[model samples]
Target: MSAMLHPISRRLFLSGAAALGGVVMLHPFAARASANQAHLRLMETTDLHVHVFPYDYYADRPNDTMGLARTAAIIDGIRAEAGNSMLIDNGDFLQGNPMGDYIAYQRGMKDGDMHPIISAMNTLGYECSTLGNHEFNYGLDFMFKVLAGANFPFVCANLTKGSLAANARDDALFIKPYVILDKTITDGAGQDHPIRVGLIGFVPPQIMNWDARHLTGKAMTRDIVKAAEAWVPQMREEGADIVIALSHSGVGPAQYEENLENASLHLAGVDGIDAIVTGHSHLDFPGPKFEGMEGVDNAKGTIGGKPAVMGGFWGSHLGLIDLMLERDGKNWRVSASTSEARPIFERVDRKAKPLVESKAEVEDAARDMHEATLAYVRTAVGKTAAPLHSYFALVADDPSVQIVSQAQTWYIADMLSETEHKDLPVLSAAAPFKAGGRGGPDYYTDVPAGDIAIKNVADLYLYPNTVQAVLVTGAQVKDWLEMSAGIFNQVEPGKADQTLINTEFPSYNFDVIDGVTYRIDLAQPPKYDPKGNLINEGANRIVALEFDGKPIDPEQKFVVASNNYRAGGGGNFPDIGPDKVIFQAPDTNRDVIVRFIVEQGTINPAADANWSFAPVDGATVLFETGPKAKDFIADVKGVAIEAAGDGADGFAQYRITL
Candidate 1:
């Protein structure tokens, strides 16, 4: 029988040779672990984001918190502990950090070129992988080039080559939707057995909205749950004994919604799937984040009665799933399953310390490429007069986000020259991508006053979202800001020392619309929830909104320049759906910001202070930011910000006089 790697004294590998007393055999699956029951181990690394080495190119320092090389140590240790194992990556492996930018912008993937991330994963001997949304950031040609060099099969059941009308089928996939591997396994009492293990993959359907520029006419996507339901049943008919799903999605509500971003929970409920691997949320499964979630056992890492796991992004964690399978006549049935996430670093004294060092071979795989990437990001592109920082972006008008808004407004004004919306006032909505929420305290942007490099641009704008313009009335504009105001927690009039920031709300969703002035009323409840659902139907948090010196006319029309994500129902803002979208620029927000900085040399960094917190009598709210906020506390407008003390997770506590 055809076989892959042989068992070496009970240690299994992925090569195609078997050795007995140091003598090689034709078939590697000759040894047996048990006669009736065979144990299978699965290791997953998701959202790698091209972190091949133990380094932070943005900070230009060695960071132990993330790296595929660091996670390789844990992978090796876990593989050593198991009898039979297979490694898989759940996607989001293409873009995120400086390394990814370097590959896309500097090193351009040619036909034969090996992507550094793929090169690193190749050395790790990955069995299979799926495409993430970020994979299309560089375009289809580049992704096809990267996939050409991958040793393992790439699968995505949702992404198809044809249009939506074609209906996604196994034959219509851009890549293979699923693969049934005729794996040979050993059972108890030294008996070799054959089993067909099916592996299917699914990415979020939002790729159409996120990377519409690269995927509009050529490709389309189907709903995750719908794709899994159609494909898993076909996999069973194709002689698959055990089926495992590689879901490049996040776990959310159990009730299925069409086009929902997070659909792993519902995908796991599909009948034929034996186990599931989840990602794209940049979170770990079985952690505190999933605690109390419906149909999820955090302790056992099971979702909808199926074993599931989501390894954290940037190689921070290695997801592990163990299955006990028993042979039943001609097929293998999963009897028991367990899952966990193993971190490469542990927090010590509010700092990350490497619990597992980088593996030697993994480091050797991409050392030269890593050094080249660092050099590429360090090249000076422009200069900044004042320091660009986002420590207090949420509390006050920030220069970092202000600069992006300024650039967007400038770009949109030029693009609207001949358009019908040219006469209408153009407002730019910019959000703080790195205000240190789930990203931790060190995640805030801190670019010093000097030459701005490509790394600074990457830090300034984290996402590769494209620039888009949404046309709406003044009333819809106010509703948009009201939705953004949900980032702040409601404070009582007489409440002192109350938390000012809503920790549950992501800083990225807190859009600060430039080209207008407004006040966020903390005394009033938010009109919308963090997910953009209208909760407080009649609640009004935005007060005294003005385009110039006068109150904004509710009936007046305006054009708001923002990213594609916001315009494509990402934040659930009212009247800002795709139908209202008037302008869709192919340029990414990062590129637009970079071009703006280059054009206006030696520009002022001072924020225009368009927004502020309205007065709440007898209220003194306290919030936490990076410790470096102490340097520019006085520059903050409207609010009275005072340094209280050091807060948890290396954040600085600040008191806000409202």
Candidate 2:
């Protein structure tokens, strides 16, 4: 005993001190490890839409706000703090921005060549992914080629192989309805438990209407909620401990009688679904507690105490859901849960900065592909004499849309070169692509006079749509404008106050056709359907139409230039279909816009006095704005700004009248 006590000599004491120092340094990590055993972290990137490398292909510049690279950085930091974690994408992984176009059309995704989106996703080791509506934009054959490059399982319950059974066998890109992954999680006792986590994916059925030509006879899509009900129970019967529904469909009210498109809340109420990851509306569900009615279990924030989350779109936010489970014998039941939305970038002094450091491996994987993507899109496609800006498109006459219409008309004009209708007067309808919406205030396109790069062309025509010319009557042309006027809400006469328009109506659908003159009677209701069918009895928004300063002849056939979607009975306008189509241009609207700019050397495609809102003299209306708009208000005519209200950080409000 005396020797043992004397063992605390200088040499031994120094060694003991060194050992204690090492333990202290490692204590924080040890405690963290113990705490993490009780919790599991899940990271989700939804609606990435081809932003893989943190660069805005439309802007042709590095954007810190978006991209899978920035999101990968955040995922790394989240994993470092959690005991166990998994990464997943919520779909809409394709068909947005110029990089997606660059890979799909320019570089071309072959069977072996790795697509940019697939390459970037592979770098992060995405455990699972779902299908989005945009995936069908390029048609089945092209989609198959691109999806073949992905290493992860492509899951979707609604889409099925139809009549293409033989083709499905030839291409292994066919996906299963659902997949059950056996994931092991360490419990509080430090025991590994094999948990069967079932994942089911759903895409909206509206693809049939939007991309019908691409999917015709090749594939079939079922309704989202119905598809979930059919497969979720099967997944549970497969010995799944927890079931997750990856719904590329969006969250709306459970009220279906009022609206058929509302599916999220209803999907949540479905049995066997433990949690849901939603997307497609491009909105963020910040917490498990959705915008449910009062007196509900706000704390749990679940449909039936089950968790749900919707990450924001375009890699803007990563959805995080933490579930706490209690063990009843060997079975696990979710006891408590919490959800949060973490953005990839945070604004500091009005500038976006990456919130975390990117994983070196992920960056290395996407670096070369990202650079090549940039170089490919940056190639000069054409030139423009005047600056292209969308400032006046929504509110008044705009040059931005005028240029697009000019391009469409010019392109269609050439395609009908050999047709008997070659000399027929041509009018082109185009909309503002950069109108403020999900892209935020900075979404507006403002290209100065000079070289119109390929990036600018993509920005001008965001979709990969080909040009088409419809044979429409003068009366039909008037109805077409009336359909576009649906973007505005009819103001009641003599009303003291009213909102100018229904903000829910997207601005991009508000078509402004060149080669015509008309006025939107705000008092009149819309006469056409979203698919371009005439429904209303006497909706006369376009009171008069003129060509070359002469009143349009209702019997005279005129070629109206529009995109393939609209000419193919999209937007539901009456008599604007393939039967009414006289010519279909080989060039896409994007390519035509580029060529138009190149030919002009400098173009003044400024919006002429084609249309305007009927004057509401002596009446005033309040218009909202961001601080950046204060300077631009002076440009608006006959409108007065009383004062600016305290709006959100990026938004400002103003009072104006017709």
Candidate 3:
């Protein structure tokens, strides 16, 4: 509804907050269109993942950067600024944090139950929504039950039931592949015209692999681009004036590969698709994040020459695509367009500053359930003798990661006691989930020493992945460690003041396998790239690897405990997939951790110094973490680190001498 959009910020106003007053009268389009021209504003929220309140249940604190209740203000303000607008959700609303877990695991959903997220969404004027991979985490029945409470209809073209029919359209799909909404458009001249708007939805095809346990034999999926090619043309043939795709995928190269997860770039090339609403990568479009991607115009927010937008995840931003439509004979064509992700808050001085307040109506809708979720997460489960934090998880063997490893090892050891691999050594693979990457500087976990609660446990393990154990040879374990060591960059011998951690490498993929000792030599090149691709074949960053006071034999087998995501090929790590998995427990990893903690009553989760960095001989490097890391710098073992200064992007910088 903004009349003008700033080039750099993509904000509606260059000066004051005039649009905050809400709902303005019909104004002239920014392009100054003729009487036949109309301006349509499309607003979207994606990957919300059950965060309806501006609160972090894990931290038990109010979070300004998250929550749809806060984003609802931005939505209301922008809709008031635009004369014509339609709101839609890009999916992933079913699961994410403790509130979702509390509802799915603790509070059961009855036939007519209303989920907190759905209740909050119903208050907002959403025309349609799509399915995200996380929606299947609770199984299809629970997902459909939650959707039944939504006020708007749901559409997903790619996800299907049973087996694939040779003709994609003829397949018995889980939901209607697409829907056409007949809407009235208001032109610049204040004239009204009837228009047919077609909206289609698509989820990543990888869901069949990622959620194989829930989807196998029950559901199937088609290639996103192929599905778009088959359905968009039919949508046009069905008297659709304009087609908009609600793609719950990320922006990748314009590579037309079948069953590719991030296929939004190629999906844009499909004929008859006018615009796209993209998400699932948790990034913002018209932002610097995707500026270098092939066929993506970050400034103009176009993918493969088609206008697109991906709102930041966790309700941080609202995706907006403003299209100036021109009448092309009997049909309307987009003459000019501008897209942006408007944030509800900004990071100033490493702290969250609210840009928009929570909407009263949306907050009221989710008020009761929000309190219930908080109560559920705050229940006392156990206690810890020492603090648990992941500030130095990437740099050293950390207690936060150690506790998860201990829990996993304990649970898996018992589960396999009666199995064929009972005699094999049990090792647990754990990673630092909240090591402060895209979640900002405050993302690190900090659970104080004392009584531990469900929220603290949830904070330690962010995802809802199930526990799994895989059997692999010693050589495969070394390869796995090499892949994990990719998180660090290769350093020149005796080079001072060099950077250490590779920011591109996600911390979750940096798995630390317990029950073994190893050394990561930064002097050698990494064997694997950040995307888990083999780069240096002969590189041996994981040197001096040993087990039980002896060098590990390459042929000897061991059972490693991990989550379903890693065991089911989520990160593309070598020699780690479903075939290698020997046992799959029905319990979630978070639940396993909780059970371990309860059994211990009060336990110490101290790091065992199982891993360390090989001395680089007077080499010094820079490391970054949350500012709060300064308080526990002395707790880091076997490394010489000192306060360096502030780093870019609001992170605290430190110098490490190896």
Clashing pairs in 1: 34-187, 34-188, 35-187, 35-188, 35-189
Candidate 1 accuracy as lDDT? 0.83
Candidate 3 per-residue C-alpha lDDT over 1-658 given as tens digits, one digit per residue, 9 for 90 to 100: 2222111133433211333643344334644866989888899999998889888787688999999988887776666667578889999988877788788878879999998899998988688999988899889999999999988889999888888889888878999999888777867777777788899999988676556668888999999988988899999998898899999998875757788778998989899999999998778997997868789888888988988999988899999998989877779888878898999888999999998778777888878888888887788768998889999999988999999999999988887775588899999999999998888899998998898998788679988678899999999999999999999988988789998989899999999999999999999999999888999999999988999989999999999999999998878899899899888664578877877887899979988889999999879999889999998888888778899999879999999888
Predicted candidate 1 versus true structure: per-residue lDDT over 1-658, tens digit per residue: 5343224334332211121123333212213335778777789999988898988776578989899988887766655555467899999898877777677877788899988888899988898998887888889998999899998999888888876544455447788889888777766565777878789998888777667668878888899888888888889999999998999888876787897778888888889999999998778987998889998999888998899998898899999887888888898898887788878888999999887767767788888888898787688767888788998899899999988998999988887875677799999998999988778878888888888886688788888688999999999999999989998889999879888888888888889999889999999999888888889998989999998899999999999999988998787777779898888764578878876877887656778788999999999988888888888887787778888888998888999888
Per-candidate TM vs. native?
0.72, 0.63, 0.72
The local lDDT score (0 to 100) that residue 342 gets in candidate 1 is: 77
Best lDDT goes to which candidate? 3
The residue ranges of model 1 lying beyond 4 angstroms of the native Cα positions read 4-34, 164-171, 385-398, 407-450, 457-513, 518-544, 553-606, 609-658
CA lDDT, candidate 1, residue 322: 79
**lDDT digits (tens) for residues 381-407 of candidate 2:** 556656677744676767678888888
